[model samples]
Target chain A: MRSDFVRREVATGLRRNVTMTVAMVLTTAISLALLGTGMLAVRTIDSTESLYADRLEIQVALTQDVSAADQDCSQPICSGLKKTLENSPLVESVTFESQQEAYTRFQQLFAGQSIADVARPQSLPATLRVKLADQQTGADAVRQAMNGQVGVRTIIDQRDVVGKLFDFLGGVRNVTFALALVQAVAALLLISNTVQVSAYTRRVEVGVMRLVGATRWYTQLPFLIEAVLTGVVGAVLAGVGLVVAKFAFIDDLLAGIAQNGVIPPITIYDVLETSIWLLPIGAAIAGVTGYVTLRLYVKV
Target chain B: MVAMATVATHEGSSLPLTLGDGRGGIRERSPRRAEGAGRTRVAGAAPGTVPTVIRLERVTKMYKTSTRPALDRVSVSVDKGEFVFLIGPSGSGKSTFLRLLLREDVPTRGRITVADLDVAKLPRRRVPRLRQRIGVVFQDFRLLPNRTVGGNVAFALEVIGKPQATIARVVPEVLELVGLEGKADRMPHELSGGEQQRVAIARAFVNRPLVLLADEPTGNLDPDTSQDIMLLLERINRTGTTVVMATHDHSIVDSMRRRVVELDLGQVVRDESRGVYGVGR
Candidate 1:
């Protein structure tokens, strides 16, 4: 068939089935939007993990001897512990925190808390802040070396905090992905149903075309093109929706963290790239669904 | 006029004409005869040796729902450029015969050939190519409602991948041929019953098919209109394109006095040269 005539037929079909076409487009758009949001979650988690990994620090709190003897930082036991951490190859740097310095830092960090006002300088535990040469590796060697140290009460690795954050973000990504899957199925069904209705309306023309020696593909191509156009339009709308959600909702919610550079922003470039990729994908999926439905259900 | 009419190749009714999935029913036909069958004319052949374009041997179509076959042991051969009328009652095998020629319904038992090709052995992918060589007009004029008369006629050429220059040149000539020269811009409903049938005939004839099958071209038109349609078909046949028309109009059949092949209860009851509708009834 002539490309010019086929295009006119597609336009006629869309106009005739306006409501079903709209439903197909909207469902496709919403599903693609959910897919884009899922991609954002993955991007955020990835950037966050890489950004904070290099700044990781392990903190060892000084022992408190309420039952027998207290930790004396200026004595031999404390001095020996500091010397060992300072000379170790795994340790990048070690800073000794006196009770006074620890309490002052606590007050600065938690100024509005009642606990900071009641805490005494001598009662506060002195912590040894040890930065690792490798941000995420070799924590086990450091722990083994300080296993039986008398001055240490607890060893806290910054990697654990990073792990917990990633776990939470991964859970969020899973939920987003699940919702995206459901929406995708709905979009596929809507596309198939709309194409079916469109084909039903054109059955008479199709029968005539077949009798006139039109090949099966020629009869089926117009419906497939209509579906592909609907999907592409839907993908464009979804991309726009994603940009709006990012600027109007996500960026605003994370404004403080983004501004302070605590976590990298989900930039407009990321949204644009993902959205650009969706155009072809949406068209392909819609085309396949329409083609399969025609093959299986519609004779023409 | 029929140039030649051959005898039935099968003498007995017991041998089924089934060669399904390339399994059975292979026959040895002369290559020269095959080539002759493909042409509208063969120069060297005398009257008795003319090419037989269609040969059906021991053909039968049995539907699971119906206890009887639609076409039972019906063997007939149509020579090139013959205008034959298939006359029968509603339950007879006229439609089934037309469908078999088009390869729309495969016969459960038979070897059918058209234009040097075994239709039963023809692959599914080749059905379109076969159909392009044949034209069919139905009881109801199945013109596309949305397309104009020219568009409906041009559609046949367009689907076959005819170049734009060819389509533009051929479409107008076909419209003139069908006596719709000024009605090219009109839609199907804008034309009367006779004009609509004429447009359909134009679409069918535009491709210049080797054979044209009219199931009931004038089944819905009045007497005067039916006469014009039959005249148009006669003109088409004069151009050396063979036509097989099936109809229930006894008066038209009696008046035309063409070669009539009558079917009764899925069997060929009589075959007459220059016969009437019910001369054999």
Candidate 2:
């Protein structure tokens, strides 16, 4: 009930076992940092998926006859396919690219590549770029509508390539979580061990206190507070570590992909948001571990 | 069964001899009265006479590891402000008797009443409150090595949430009473064995408890040092605190000539007023 006494006891307990206290703090910090990184990776993956989802579209390539014959999609065969696609309920909008325009875009897509030299205007086929209202079922509906029609060649779903990128990011998240779990287990052992050692070192004083009318809870409270204090300090260290990692590690590692807008950047805000959660999570783990250790191994 | 007959004869014949205060009638009814709710009331005492502060009725303790009970059907009482000695061999349950009074261990059977609180019936959460009314000292002194003498004494009040003002005011008073006023700033290791015991006594007595239970207070000290400590305890006993001490030291008990209860094999063999150690054995 006395704050000063509790504070004094906590300070003494932590100071008496300085090495164990430091070990506990460092372990908790590393584990919580890994957990924060895993959470941020998940956020990044979600944002990247939404960013590409807005621009996702299906490409419909026409036959070579259509490419050679149609100049501006003014011919009946070319214009008819564009009109049908635009009229479908699944299609949000349709734009046609002639062979010459497709060739220009292809050169821009691979400007510095050796393959650009082999492509001519007649080599690239005329195509219709179709934006869908819904990504999940619209691509199938568009492919079914144009199946085996005259002047139609193939339908390309862009999501197939983008899905691979997401899979890689998901893998990163899973790996981070798995590593975090392992580190968390290490941190748990350290916390419990520290509590036990601290309790053991102070057994004489605690026994005296109990004999002199101090409650069991009163004697054990200092140990609990010491654990929680270490946990909170570790959380603060983990938060700082996350912010530094964003700039020092994550940004540099993700530079190329983030520049191309293939994945969202790991911002300071994202790291901070994830870091805020580590405080409570760290405290809960330390508190529960302290309580259980005392109950099971140490009487006081 | 032989011990039970010995106990009956001892109670019937020796009970009257020990009633030195002329309260023999009330003393005779105590075992029956302890069984009921009237244990706290001194039925026929003079207007200002002290009431019974501790009572044990047919108390028995059986530790599972051993067939012999640690204590067997032990019955005794001590009045307020009285100094009583529990003398026995090492394994004759002297320490167990003090431990049961402190509620550190429970008797397997029978009732113990200390400061009007039934030991068995007290709730676990309320045990601390019961202990607050009693002070305990051990042979080892059990002082916190890291804390100063003042800090160790103040610790007793601090853990119970006493304010800083009260701790500052009362710690020095207790230290002075125990004759360690100037040694408050010294650590436990800095003091001699006798002085260290004084610090432990200061800590225990700082709370002004109703009863003081000492388990071999002089077990670790020299003869001269033990005598000094006994004098200090006697001084404290004069302040109206009941003192129950268990000891293996015969000289101190024989010299003090206080009421002595002798135990042998977990049974009370003799309880005498102004008794000496090993008087008839």
Note the DockQ of each predicted structure: 0.49, 0.69
Q: What would the TM-scores of all predictions be?
A: 0.84, 0.85
- Residue range A21-135, candidate 2, lDDT tens digits: 9999999999999999889979988899889987988989999998899978899998999999988888899988889999899999899999999989988898999999878
Off by over 4 Å in 1: A65-105, A111-124, A128-149, B1-49, B60-68, B107-109, B279-281
TM-score of 1: 0.84
lDDT of 2 by residue, B45-143 (tens): 442355778988889999999899988888888877778889989899898898888788999999899978999788988889988989988899999
Predicted model with the maximum TM-score: 2
Instruction: Give fnat for candidate 2.
Output: 0.81
The candidate scoring highest on DockQ is: 2
- Candidate 1 Cα deviation (angstroms), residue B224: 2.6
| Candidate with best lDDT | 2
